[model samples]
Target: MSSPEHKQKIWKMIKDIKVGMLVTLDNGVPRARPMHLVQDEYDGTLWFFTRRSAEKVFETAGDQDVCLSFSDQEEGVYVSLSGKADLTDDRELIEKYWNPFIAAWFHDGKDDPDVALLEIKVQMGEHWKAKESKTFQLYEIAKANVKKDATPNLGENEKFGG
Candidate 1:
């Protein structure tokens, strides 16, 4: 409906943004992969079901900082969340979200010793619009020709008639 309402919905979508792309660094670059995940409403924690032996799991083994992104087709919106990812070899959760399809990956079994879960806690995020009919080029154009201005630091204009 309105701009604020749209933004609100984008924020709320985190609750249903089932799958998010996890971006990690290999050798000081970027790598993107998709993952099905659950979301925490109050504190914005993203839960993902994955295998402990997966490449992603290994990448985060030494690093906790990461980026989680979620988007949907219903609306032209997307959210890129930057946060820390904690890897746990928890067997219980591994069996919880396991399905028959996953048997292909874990020959050892769904509750195999290598299966695990990745818990990502979001810190701060940026939301953007993605249109199917037309690419999101508005921000790109404005951003390209954008002008920079310097402003006074905070509290500079906070003197209350003293």
Candidate 2:
């Protein structure tokens, strides 16, 4: 279990950057695809809309362990999350996350048989955030290069959860 504060911190980092690359093992090979994160709050779980017949769904059914990678280059923030994924057709959950954008895929809307929820119960996550401006970061790198014995201060790196 993760603390509420930790979940909030993760949510704040990812809220603006809503898309993530979800990776799952396929026949012992890593397969990855972009997924749009659907959520209103963070509770140690991430949700995405997926078709019931989607390859990711099938992959998760075989191996629940998954990884999600999120990045915002402009903000200099990157996060990697590991979790267990499962597919569900629960009506309430489907309705809760349904949006007009999702209709583009599920033409039949929330009631569509193909519409399903991909729930990821996050177990661990690591985030790297750069607090300094890019210009300053560049200067730091140059200074480090001149010194030869120093390393650039890029930012803070934190690991949370199990």
Candidate 3:
């Protein structure tokens, strides 16, 4: 099990990254698509809205294993989440995560029968975050080169599991 601190760190790194690359296997071939993250609280589960007839739905049905990647290059934060995906038609959850922006895609709004929720129960996650500013990073590089020292510390790299 992941510690609360680790989970919180993971959430903090990904919260601002609204878009994630959801990777699913299509007949043994890996396929990835950008998905909008719907939930704020992590709690080891991530939710995404999609259509019932989407290729990802069929792909996930065949194999539940999935990967979600979130990156913010400016902030130098990257997170990779591995999990199992389950498709659900639960209206309550759909409504909970629904927003006007998402409604544009569903045509019929919250009542759209084709609306499906991809519930990704996260099993494990790895994260890399750079704590220093870009300018500071450049300074470190220069200092390392001038002094022939090892590279400077580059924030954190961690792994967590639920």
Candidate number of the best lDDT: 2
Give the least accurate 10-residue stretch of model 3, judged by summed lDDT: 1-10
Candidate 1 C-alpha lDDT tens digits along 10-66: 457665766778998776678889887543333445667677668887778767779
Off by over 4 Å in 1: 1-11, 15-17, 38-42, 99-107, 129-162
- TM values, all candidates: 0.63, 0.96, 0.90
lDDT, candidate 3, residue 115? 93
**What is the lDDT for 46 in model 3?**
88
Q: Model 2: how far is 97 from its true place, Å?
A: 0.8
Q: Candidate 2, which segments miss by more than 4 Å at Cα?
A: none
Report clashes for each candidate as comma-separated counts: 0, 0, 0
Task: Give the per-residue lDDT of model 2 (tens digit) for 53-151.
Answer: 998998999999999999999999999999999899999988888888888888877897888999999999899999899998999899999999999
Better of 1 and 3 by lDDT: 3
lDDT of 2: 0.92
Pairs of colliding residues, candidate 3 = none
